[model samples]
Target chain A: MSEAVQLRRRLLLLTPLGVAAAGGVAFLAMLRGMQSGNFDPRGVPSPLVGRRIPDFSLPAQPPDGVGFGSADLLAAGRPVLVNFFASWCVPCVLEAPVLMQLKEAGVPIWGVAYKDQPDAAAQFLRANGDPYARLARDEPGRVAIDFGVYGVPESYFVDRSGIVRWRWAGGLSADTVSQELQPLLRKYA
Target chain B: MRTLLLLLLLAGPAWAVSSPSEMLPDRAQEQRAERIGEQLRCLVCQNQSIEDSEADLARDLRGIVRSRVVAGDSDRQVIAWMQARYGDFVRLDPPFRPLTWLLWSSPVLALAVGAGAVLAGRRRHAAPAPLSDAERARLADLL
Candidate 1:
């Protein structure tokens, strides 16, 4: 075959190989990003870590409109555990009973229903046995955003001084509550 | 349930009060998130943005963008924060760092090399003006 024709044929074969190589590199890049947690679904913590909670208030949901705010929970003479949940979230369902147990033990708990209909939130609480000291509705998810919540079923451990002590992103099991939460409570309890 | 649904529909008009953000803050931050998000690579989708993607990870990233804004971080700072945590892979247009210099330079380098080879081959094949006709005839007689 002529050299030019041979070169053309070789070029055709090399083009697809080059494309595949580029694709492989891109795939590896994507896999690496996932593993590193940069693209994490739960919003990452900011340098605001050691800072006090922001100031805001939500009109408490019906059956309780206690004007809950940063001070109501923080100034009440006890460290607070604020659980951000949604009636639509399944993990929240699992964590509900555990929270009820905490409530039974007299651990003060607050609920922030994220982007949920208030009536649905009320019904869920009633059916599952309300564990919240007072419920706040974040109908537009503003409060949750302000709190840096990544998704439903996140819990924040705030100390008596109103500083956020720790953040839990997923479902809270008894083990986590005992090992992680209870210790924080002991410090401020 | 039915009663709340009716209330929600009635409240639809009032949704305008909050602007149906479906997210925190408002349009300015949402638009900024989308702009920044489009530049971010979704870990799950691997090709889409957390803003454009519906994957759980993307949704999380979207929340992260809003959270950063609420935390009083600037757009550049938020992007830098993600880059630090996730590395260049999380950014669609990752900065030109030492590690990525190779990735960004290879294609252009390859094209230049290929062009050089093609030109060199052409030059090698070009006739250096043939020996004069007299020189050609004398060479033929010696053969």
Candidate 2:
């Protein structure tokens, strides 16, 4: 081959390989982040953080549970956890004990039964352990949508002024409660 | 190649998720809602648009979009409303912003890298040896 042609051919061959190497490095870094729990593929950051709770008022959960709204959260006088959960959500069941622990520690917890049938929700609470001080039913899910809830078992920590300080999208565990929620609650408190 | 084709087609079973009961009465508005919904990611379903996911959240999102349409929101306003609530993650088409500028600029970066690589490779092989006198004679004959 001609000298110039050989030079051009080498350039063509090496350029794609360099690009492939760059792509591979990026992919490996992502895998490391995922493995180290530094990145959660499923966790979506909430925009409502640091903003006031959206306008919403839900009716009481069925079978005599008390109802609450944005104003109620403002009047809480301390940080409160507003949890969107449902009877059908298995993660909510897993999250229940940690929620109860928080409630026992004098943290006021509000519940929104997201898209759950009234009777089913009431029964689920009774069976899974009700830790909520006041409960509401998001029957049509409008309130939950306004609060930017995507799935059941999501929780938002609202400051006394009703600002959403933190939001967790998945089921809360003891570790999450102790590590993330407690510190955030303390900060706003 | 099959995976690439699947990604091009959104890699999912595209089903009719928005039912007639949930549609707007005005056909044009409903169509607008549908178009908007197709551009929105369903929060409950990974990588599926609200228009393609059977999840309840997607249905709610569809209704929300229609409500905004009914209230006379422009397409940008409707999308902004969603972004206000759900962050830029709600959009199937990601917004170009500071946090996501890297993602948007990645293609440019890749092209730059490739160009750089080609230039470097070209330089490393620069000044190739002069053709043999015999080869030059052969080249002259061919020309």
Instruction: Per model, state how many residue pairs clash.
Output: 0, 0
Q: lDDT per prediction?
A: 0.75, 0.87
TM-score of 1: 0.54
Runs off by more than 4 Å, candidate 2 = A1-37, A62-65, B1-18, B127-143
Docking class of 1: incorrect
- Fnat: each model in turn: 0.00, 0.73
lDDT (0-100) at residue A36 of candidate 1? 49
| TM-score, per-candidate, Cα-based | 0.54, 0.80
Candidate 2 C-alpha lDDT tens digits along A1-189: 679879978988998899999999999999998865558877677999999999878899966556877888887798889999999999999999999899889898889999889899999989989998888998898888888888888999988888889898878888788778888877877
> Model 1, range B20-63, lDDT digits (tens) per residue?
45466577876666677778777556676666676654666777
- Write the residue-wise lDDT of candidate 2 on B1-143 in tens digits: 99999798974554365456786789899889889988988988869989888898887788789898999999999999999889888888998889999999999999998999899879878887789999999999999
lDDT of 1 by residue, A90-144 (tens): 9999998999999999988888888788899888888887888888888876666
Best by DockQ: 2
- Residue A101 displacement in candidate 1 (angstroms): 0.5
Classified by CAPRI criteria, candidate 2 counts as medium
